[model samples]
Target: MDVLRYVAFATDASGGNPAGVVLDASGADEAAMLAVAAEVGYSETAFAVPRPDGGLDVRYFSPLAEVSFCGHATIATAVAHAREHGPGARDFHTRAGLVRVGTSVGADGVITAELVSVPPRSVPPAPDDLPELLAALRWSADELDPALPPRIAYAGAWHPVIAASTRQRLAALDYDMAALGDLMRRRDWTTVDLVWRESETVFHARNPFPPGGVVEDPATGAAAGAFGGYLRELGLVALPAELTIHQGDDMGRPSVLTVGIPADPAEGISVRGAAVPIPD
Candidate 1:
């Protein structure tokens, strides 16, 4: 199988999060996929096998292990499929659930893909999980934004949503990798979403993905989806809001993620972005 490289959430290859996409993985087994993911060395790699029912059976793997779903990888895979087949709506059956993705060409002929996440939910982290989590990140209780209280949000994968009161606090991310990784493994969290709200409709984000063996994710679509749900669940945003999330600037791989949060709580969140091919 050809492993294609694509960077999602950026118009150019220099930005966004890089992901490996395997258009055809029908013959490969779990071990082979894991090996490929490790070789790719990205935050996650997506393997897609076309189904007879017209959908694709997709799986996401990090360097270390497989995950239920991944947002950036899904976006990359959708763009790759669109470039090869055509741009339109497609269904993906993942370990998490069914994810519906749609691709469209813009006036500039750039292809942008949007993925609707599975129904999302958020809840307070277990009492025992919060203190340890904060300690690992070296963040104090007062440093957190009281308005956007902490919660563990899930769209496809689980992420702990922690909002910082100041942008500087969000940018200064020096967490204990080993401690965070162990906590994430025990809690089944894919990443830690550290965010700072710029306005009612704009935000800045940084993701620590120690569990995936990734120091940081330049852009995280899954966490964006979960963050949207977190805002909606906590009544933090007005209904039918559009949020722009800026991430990876400190890492120098800036990424922009557009999040659409519908009014209905049962509806899935929509995360949209443009992806580009990474030169070989």
Candidate 2:
């Protein structure tokens, strides 16, 4: 199988999150897919088999394990599909759910993709686990933003939403990887969505993905979708709002994600970004 590499959420290859896309993996088994993902060594890789109904059955695998859904990988795969065939909309049946993704070529020949996540949802953080969680991250309760309370948000995967009170607090991220990773694995959390709201419609984010065997994700699409749900559920933004998330800046691989929140709470959130090929 051919493994194509692309960086999602950024026009340049040096930015965004790199993902391995296997456009045709119909013959690959679970073990084979996992082995491929581990060899690629990205946060996640996508393996897709085209279905008879014109859709795709996609599976996501990190270096360590399989994840239900991955936003950046999805974006990269969709753009790769568009580049190979043509720009259009298609459904990706993932372990989490069926995600609809559309791709379009811009005037400058840049390919952009948008994925509509499954219906988003959120729940309050587990009171019994918050203390240990904070201890692992070395964050105190006072460092949290009062306006944006903590919540476990879900679009395709689970992510704990933690809002830092200041940009400095978010930037100073020196966490116990082993401690946080153990906590996250037990809690079944994909990543810790550490964020700082710069303005009403703009925010900065960092994602620690221990379960995926990655220290941090340069641009996490799934967490971005979940964060949109968190903001909508908390009434932090007006209905039918558009939000911009700046991520991977502190890591030096700057990436941008645009989120569109609809008025209907039951509707899925929309995440849009661009993907470019990464040279071997």
Candidate 3:
């Protein structure tokens, strides 16, 4: 039903993570939305139904199942809405919580969207689950970064944050798809946030989204937001910091995501990126 394709977090259409946007899907049922998402076959498809108050009721669906939240799709949808309705602020009521998005056009005619996530929190992963996760990822304990440790972080969605001691380890991403998918489904994880810290403000990330039927996500804004929280919650980074995440380079569709962490621990993290339209 009139699906628009856009790549978020990249100025070029060939970069970033592609997402399907349905600006108006009020008439579609859950099954209909799911069918449409499958047809689009992107990592995620965002369906928006306008509310009477000028807000939107948004839902995200992958080819396989409905997701509580999706960052790149949200960025894509907000940018799409801005291009059609004019750049401004919009509120989205999602299954996870209320998300606030602000869009503006740069002098170069590029539109950037910034989303403030719901209050994020981080918790240590279940002890019993770490072994299975490590086995599925084919990573040894010694390969992990001692600073970041392993934890499940949640902003609008949940992701297990894993840090590699070196960029080389992070880049070697061969994993057991079936085992990871089964574990993710059982644990209800949206993605596995694999990261390598280049500096205090710079990082490289890769998201393995087996549950969504994707080998990897080029750019994952939700995971970035959650990672910001993870860093703040665990005192890994200074407060009121701005971090740059480089992702998808290994896949050749390079993407960049900017995350802003506030001083307040209870506040939501800000994820910002640009989305470009994919021509037909």
Q: Which regions of candidate 2 fall more than 4 Å away from where they truly are?
A: none
Report the number of backbone clashes for model 2: 0
How does each model score on TM-score? 0.99, 0.99, 0.99
Q: For this target, which candidate reaches the highest lDDT against the unseen true structure? A: 3
Please, what is the whole-model Cα lDDT of each candidate in the order they appear?
Answer: 0.96, 0.96, 0.97
Tens digit per residue, CA lDDT, model 1, 1-280:
8999999999999999999999999999999999999999999999999999878999999999999999999999999999999999999999999999999999987789999999999988999999999999999999999988989999999999999999999989999999999999999999999999999999999999998899999999999999999999989999999999999998999999999999999999999999999997
Q: List, residue by residue over 1-280, the lDDT tens digit for candidate 2.
A: 8999999999999999999999999999999999999999999999999999988999999999999999999999999999999999999999999999999999999999999999999998788778888999999999999999889999999999999999999999999999999999998999999999999999999999988899999999999999998888889999999999999999999999999999899999999999999987
Tens-digit lDDT track of model 3 for 56-152: 9999999999999999999999999999999999999999999999999999999999999999998888988889999999999999999889999
Off by over 4 Å in 1: none
lDDT of 1: 0.96
Clashing pairs in 1: none
In model 3, where do residues sit more than 4 Å from their true spots? Answer: none
Q: What local lDDT does model 2 show for residue 273? A: 100
